[model samples]
Target: MKKSGMSLLEIVISISIAVVIFIPAMNMFSTTGQAVFKTRNFSFANSAARRISQRLMAMPYEDIVEVPLPGIALFDAPAESFFAPFLNTSGTNSGAKNITQADMPEFYSYLVQHDFRYSLSVSNVSFGDGDEIKSVGILITWSENNKNMMYRLYVYVPSL
Candidate 1:
């Protein structure tokens, strides 16, 4: 009687084929996943840079130039949402909405918790044409394993 079953050689061949196909497919999936993760991180960094740049541009100009406390960097000041209204031209909640050195950590902490590392640099450039440009540069850096990423945004406020 003829046995109705796959031969041992046939079974082995089938399994081998499956492993060959599955190995490459699984590798492809993992690679795609890593690329997606990196893209997402990059997008987040870009957004954070944009957010801070917009905040600087929306300032009343005067506040942007107001020197920070001695020994403190300008960008490092107004490091909290509490100081938003103060930097802008309008709005009043209650009491003085000031940003202290203590608030700096809160801002950095917020970004770090959100998976972003942020740093900002501001400069005032006056051209010979009598045009003054206030440039605010925001840099956001983050890393995963051996992969490193950064985003820089430059916002210029021309003399109005």
Candidate 2:
């Protein structure tokens, strides 16, 4: 009599082949997804850093105050004024002087909206004696899989 259906051996062979092919395909898909995510985050972080740098650059050379205002830390500014536009702070008044601990106002908010975490830093560079040009650095950092991602931006401000 002729067999009407696939034999058990044939069925098992087909299932095994399918699994072998499927696992690698699935792995590839997962890897690609992770890579895409990383690329997106990098792009976002870089954009944010550039935006902040542009704002700093726009400031008049003399208006770019590197010195900490009284009651503020080094290279720090009131969060409400600088970051509020980007990060959502509850209080109308930003008493926070530290730029790091302060909640992200503008850029941070954007990152949060996109499910990305980030941090920023600004520093002033001064040569010996009084120099009209000041160097500003903006550092942005984020995280994925408990690993930190970072980007740096530098700008030179001429005296206004």
Candidate 3:
């Protein structure tokens, strides 16, 4: 008698091969998805840093001085530890100076809407141009896949 259908052994072998191929394909897809997410997050953080840097560059050269204004605070308190030195806390107000969302409502709102936190600081830097140049640094932080990620940007502004 000729068998018109696959034997049980053949059927089992085919199923096993399919499962082996499927598992690795599924894993590859998962890894690709994770990589895509990380790239997107990095792009977003970089953009935010650039935006803050542009704002700093737009300010008058003298305004880059570290001033102690009361209402300017960091978006995240923890960031203060890493950015204290660059902070400009020596200008006018002396009442608990901090950089808060209120300082730039538009920036703050955009960050909040995207679940990001940022810190901006300015410091004196001599770029072979005496004391006429200032350095501005912006740090943009966000969480991705339970990991903390940060993007940093630095810009030099001249007294022009």
lDDT (CA) per prediction: 0.60, 0.57, 0.62
Candidate number with greatest lDDT: 3
lDDT of 3: 0.62
Where does model 2 exceed 4 Å of error? Answer: 60-83, 87-110, 113-130
lDDT of 1: 0.60
Error of model 2, residue 65, in angstroms: 6.5
> Per-candidate TM vs. native?
0.59, 0.61, 0.57
Residue-level lDDT of model 1, residues 59-142, one tens digit each, is 666455532212132223444532232344335444433333353456544444434455556688787686778876677766
- Number of the top-ranking candidate, with TM-score as the measure: 2
Q: Model 2, 1-160: lDDT tens per residue?
A: 8879999999999999999999999999999999998888778768866766677767555555543212121122344333434533356545332333344355344454444332333345556576556666555565576776666677767654
Kindly report which residue stretches of model 3 are placed more than 4 angstroms away from their true locations once superposed. Answer: 1-8, 61-114, 125-130
Model 2: how far residue 44 lies from native, Å? 0.6
Worst 10 residues of 1 by lDDT: 66-75
Span of 10 residues, lowest total lDDT, candidate 3: 67-76
Deviation (Å) of 47 in candidate 1: 1.6
Residue 144 shift from truth in candidate 2, angstroms: 0.9
Comparing 1 with 2 on lDDT, the higher-scoring candidate is 1
State the lDDT at 18 in candidate 1: 100
